[model samples]
Target: MQHLSRRQFAKAAFWLPTLALAGPAWAQTGDDPVEFVESQYNNIYIYKRGTQVSMTFGHNKRLYTESVMDTTDTKALPVEYTKFMTAAVAYTKKQDSILQIGLGGGRTSWYLHVHLPDAAIDVAEIDPVVIDLAKKYFAVKEEKNFAPVAMDGRLFLLRNPAKRYDLICIDAYRGPFVPFHLLTKEFYVKVAEHLTEGGIVAQNVEPSTMVFNAAVATMKSVFRQVDFFPAAGNVVLVAYNDAERLSDAELLKRAEALQAKYAFRYPLTDLVKGRREPSNPVKGQILTDDFAPVETLHAIERKNEKWK
Candidate 1:
């Protein structure tokens, strides 16, 4: 196994203990926060604020929130598009089953389980620590209909040939970068393979990234139709397996139906209103497993060239 030098190792070990004194650290006085961190991926920070319990992944000088739950009620989704993700139920012809990638705090999966009790909700998570946090702190129950498996999202899809889903939600982010492998056309082809006829995929995308267009293009290569729904700063891409486009008028009708039946805390109509096609569908190069430049593109996006 590769080993970190004492100096390098200490950097990862440092400041974690100091934060506990900072407040609501996910550990007791004798416990260590370093235990929650995964190798070379993220330094996990778990904390609680009043009725909210949250998890953050710190990497590349940015602390991205992994998940947050309302301690008072797990059914109430704290994130905006998690409610929007339910919009998939509107677009898809069936709501029999779902495959959600990236368990995080397990709020999305939990919400799906509660709202669509009849649907089989399967969640594939890459990190055991994330799963533990969800169950222990976030109140995600494991029942017959709700299955939480510890596996990479892509591998989970590849391995489960017999299993198919009406909707597949992909929002797997690793540290500062969305996993390059997950953003590729080839991976989405696998995602398309796991879908039932008339199935749709709901993916949480970082529109701020320079590679956003490329990411959409990659998805479009596999799925016949792709639509974008604005969510705060991010966008959720709903890709349909069949070659058909849905107009805003059409989506609004569907959204209204879901909102009336479910009465989501955040009305599903906003997601419908936020709908639009890719501004530059062919702008960025299509990402592929063998030739993805996600990190490079992100770095370019971060670099402010306005001054130059």
Candidate 2:
């Protein structure tokens, strides 16, 4: 494991995702039309392009995508980062239960519910409109097995009495920036409490911003092992409860079995191979509840990326 100092990590690393390779027009897999809009802290919208539907924040860019034709969460899997989230399966023998912090289009939660109907799945989405849109347009069914809790991600972790899950995923996005509360070291500590033995917590991180390195560092502070999968404009961090890291061969062995059983479109074999170790961030530089300059970092990253 390469343990670079905080300063070294910041110097060597870039931030997280914009899915630059993924625009409705770029993918050409959709006939995008504005379906619903709610303007607030984040300009949330549900866009429809042919049978393809997506969740967009702030702009027309598809942050979370889905397809009405194939509601299995496969057709809607437009971004590689979303595919990378599923790599958490490599850490477990069975997907007993899952807790997702964000419910963008409800694709991740929906996929688990569909694939593992017998398993319990809970989703924490702060936006009620996003939840409504998930059902109305995105075809995310309201199933008894899948619970959609309208609450903040951090609060859900702190308050929820059910303190264990086989897998946990965090993908909260506020406009183009991440919620500071959700990116803190304290937040990850709460996440760690909920993880069962051999459990995995996978997060979608955008590396095109300054928060990327700090975010990974915060996660590293709590979890014994952290691994990553590089996706288009993003990186998926998979932190494990176990101290020992799984080799690529072992992860692939589990990936192959799960793939055979589920016949997943995004192969776990491919995702498991992109595993990267985490590096430490500088002291006091990592995000915390009291001080997380997420908006500021995002602004800097946007300018640095030359994104208007």
Candidate 3:
């Protein structure tokens, strides 16, 4: 795996996908037609290309892929960030209760539900339309232990004060940006409160945006220890309240054990191997509920990058 610089990430997130879409191979053919389009929280589009089905949020004539799944193989995660997202399991030994903040196509939730049959999984998807499409087109289903709810992620945590999860996965995004409320220090405080002791929270962050550093800072404010796993244009941040940090060797050892036990499609060991130190003296202000300028920061960052 290659480590991308901030600028490289921006290019990959913005330009690479756009360029790919312009190519003949990516042009929408009769076989790759849009399956559904709805307007609720955002303008959502679901399309299929051969065996791959994807969910994209449309904004300003641009489409940002929120989730992708292989129709032929529901268990296969076609997105790179998703594969790394599952590596969150390597940080904790318990999988009794898991909470996912975003449901996208429910690929991550479905994958975890299948792999961890005994674990209880709760998913919070803000858009009810996405949940419906996820079930109809992506094979997301409510089973004995798996449940997907349509509600704001923060609200879900606030509503369930007594519920504590052993692992919390945050991959929530609206188009190219994360909901402002989800990026604040206050929200992370709530997230930390709902975690069981020694529990870990894994978040998928777009390193290209200005919010990236601030999001990291905000999580660090709430979590005692933070680690990074950079994959493609995204960096999965795994944070916990534990005082002692887990070393690379220890993480690798744990990943190896979990890999042997579960036989994951994307080897956990490969994901753990990409773990490295985050940027030093973390640059960016700690985001608070009272002052989390997510959209403004993203706009400014995009403008600055465009000229350079």
Candidate 4:
């Protein structure tokens, strides 16, 4: 796992929804009236006139409800996402089961449903409002292959211990940032507990941000082998508990095969590069509930460009 700045990551992830909820300070702006809606205990401010959503940070940054559907954007489905999916597809043929932890605008969920028709997808989202908004505004459709589970991902995974998935995607984020509990060693181990043999966990980690280093450290503690794919200022961590190594040559060959099959834009070029020489090659620290301090690691990444 690596860390990246929120601003840099935001730029890289142009398709991700910007979080700028409305607050009392926004009410002071009398002329531009903003409607506020609370979802999952978070305040979401919608501009009464247009598609822009306001931020509570006092800086009025607006994001369109339509951009959420554009999975091609680096933020939504970063190049790393396509690469990880390619690898997962290669590894598990014949429409294996795929589980996604988060469903923001249903970008990855819809893409997987459309592309991997044979694969069964289970999407767990904490906020139904986001899911509903994605459907109303982002044009996210649900089909037989897609199962939307409105529940906390951690609790769901724990409850369904028998459920094993071939590919698991963890993209849970909290208002422009990843929640600290979700990035801990304990949580990752729980993720491992629900995985099938040879299954890979693809985690969307913002390395430049505060949560990046702790996430990497936590992931390392659970999986026997972990690899990174950097794209759009974010790192997608693919962890394998069963195998220590996945041959680079094999991975490249498979990537090429997938590109021909799917015609993906980013495909597997950069993923292959990361495999050769990773940014954080050695294990740094284990991220436990009490001991993890991801913010500090994020600060170090900001100072040292070598992590990239």
Best by TM-score: 3
- Candidates sorted by lDDT, descending order? 3, 1, 2, 4
User: What Cα-based lDDT does every candidate model obtain?
Assistant: 0.72, 0.68, 0.80, 0.60
Compared with the true structure, what per-residue lDDT tens digits does model 1 show for residues 1-308?
12121112122222333354335543344432323555444567675554666666766555566676767777876666666666666787777899999988887778878877888999999887788777888898789889999899989988998899998998898755678888898899888889998888998776655777778788878888877776555667889965568877887888788778777666778756666654433466788889998878876562211110
On residues 1-308, what C-alpha lDDT tens digit does candidate 2 reach at each position?
Answer: 12121122211221111123344553564534466566444555454433345555644343333222233334445555666788887777568788989887776677667767777898998888778877886677777779898888888987985768999999887755677889888888888888887778999877766677678778877887777776656778888867687877888899999888876666778878777643432222577888888777765542122111
Candidate with top lDDT is 3
- Taking all chains together, each candidate's TM-score versus the true structure is 0.82, 0.79, 0.88, 0.73
Model 4 global lDDT (CA atoms, 0 to 1): 0.60
Please report how far candidate 3 places residue 279 from its true position, in Å: 5.0
Order the numbered candidates by TM-score, best leading.
3, 1, 2, 4
**Candidate 4 Cα misplacement greater than 4 A, ranges:** 1-36, 45-67, 71-95, 259-276, 279-283, 294-301
TM-score of 3: 0.88
Can you write out model 3's per-residue Cα lDDT over 79-180, one digit (the tens) per residue? 777777898998887889999999989988889899988889999989998898899889988888899999999999999999999999998988777889
Error of 4 at 305 (Å): 3.9
Q: Which stretches of candidate 2 lie over 4 Å from their true place?
A: 1-33, 39-41, 59-76, 276-284, 302-308
Worst 10 residues of 2 by lDDT: 9-18
- Give the poorly placed runs of model 3, Cα more than 4 Å off: 1-32, 302-308
